[model samples]
Target: MLKKSDMIAMALGVVLGAAATVPAFAAGGGGDPPPPPTCAKGQVYSAKKNACVKAERGALPDEEMTQYAYALAKQDRFQEALNMLDLLENPNTPKALNYRGFATRKLGHTEEGISYYLKSVALDPNYAQVREYLGEAYVIQGKLDLANSQLATIKTICGTGCEEYEDLARAIEDSKL
Candidate 1:
């Protein structure tokens, strides 16, 4: 008889294989292709390739709620960004929460923004941009230790010369002022 650990490993392998094959068959039209994801405005249906195009133009949203929030944030209209964030189908999504947190922070709701930023980080710890913003928020609140920790993590994840790394570095430095 197989040992317990061996059985467990075999089960895990089967599950993983099934999971992998499901995606492959799904992509091959085993079912109808999923409906295209929508743009933030709800005015346009986005093809897969178009979902992240706006980021290339220095517009940060590029996908669903994020794009809407970015547009409002660009106008320095943080309340509107919050409103758009509220309208997202999946408000708990890290991207949505991150944008909302950023917008709220811009509007001077620092505590509320920090809460949302924390939520975003909890949802996706690997999201370097969210970590950067969380560090900025901590700095704004005079939480230097937390800010430094987050900044160090951002540096490690985003790479030394990346725009996010530079931005976080600047924010950290400015916070000391």
Candidate 2:
């Protein structure tokens, strides 16, 4: 009793319905697989081995860069730390800039050190340590006002008699004469 067009349309509807239902039935047996972890470019996932491998141009994380820079600085390898900072993809991270600045300061590169310190503070104004370092840098450069501003912030964050507080207080007193 059905017209040809109606039968054809009905057949197509059934086919489409089955097509949609088939995936639901197939998916019912097992829950969806966990999503793959995302990695930076130049990183590869080895499915057979179930591990991620770094490719030649892969970049390290900001935290790792800071740790490596600290290690190099501890070993008196300031230049190496600077080189590593230069290689980081996210070189502008506050920690990395702070480490680089600290290393440069230790190596007697005062201007470059202050530049990095300023950059670090600009990137993360809430970082108490960077503010302390900036204050110290200003003291070294004989800029009392700038140093006092930073020292006041450090004092507020660290409170009285903390190591940095004592140091900055002494520097401010010395700069007064």
The candidate maximizing TM-score is: 1
Model 2 Cα shift for residue 49 (angstroms): 16
**lDDT by candidate, in order shown:** 0.71, 0.71
TM-score of each: 0.63, 0.59
Residue 112, candidate 1: alpha-carbon lDDT: 93
Cα lDDT tens digits for candidate 1, 99-164: 888998998898999999899989998788788888888888889899889878877786776656
Give the C-alpha lDDT of model 2.
0.71
Q: Which ten-residue region of model 2 has the weakest summed lDDT? A: 29-38
Model 1 accuracy (lDDT, Cα):
0.71
After superposition of all CA atoms, the RMSD between model 1 and the true structure is 12.4
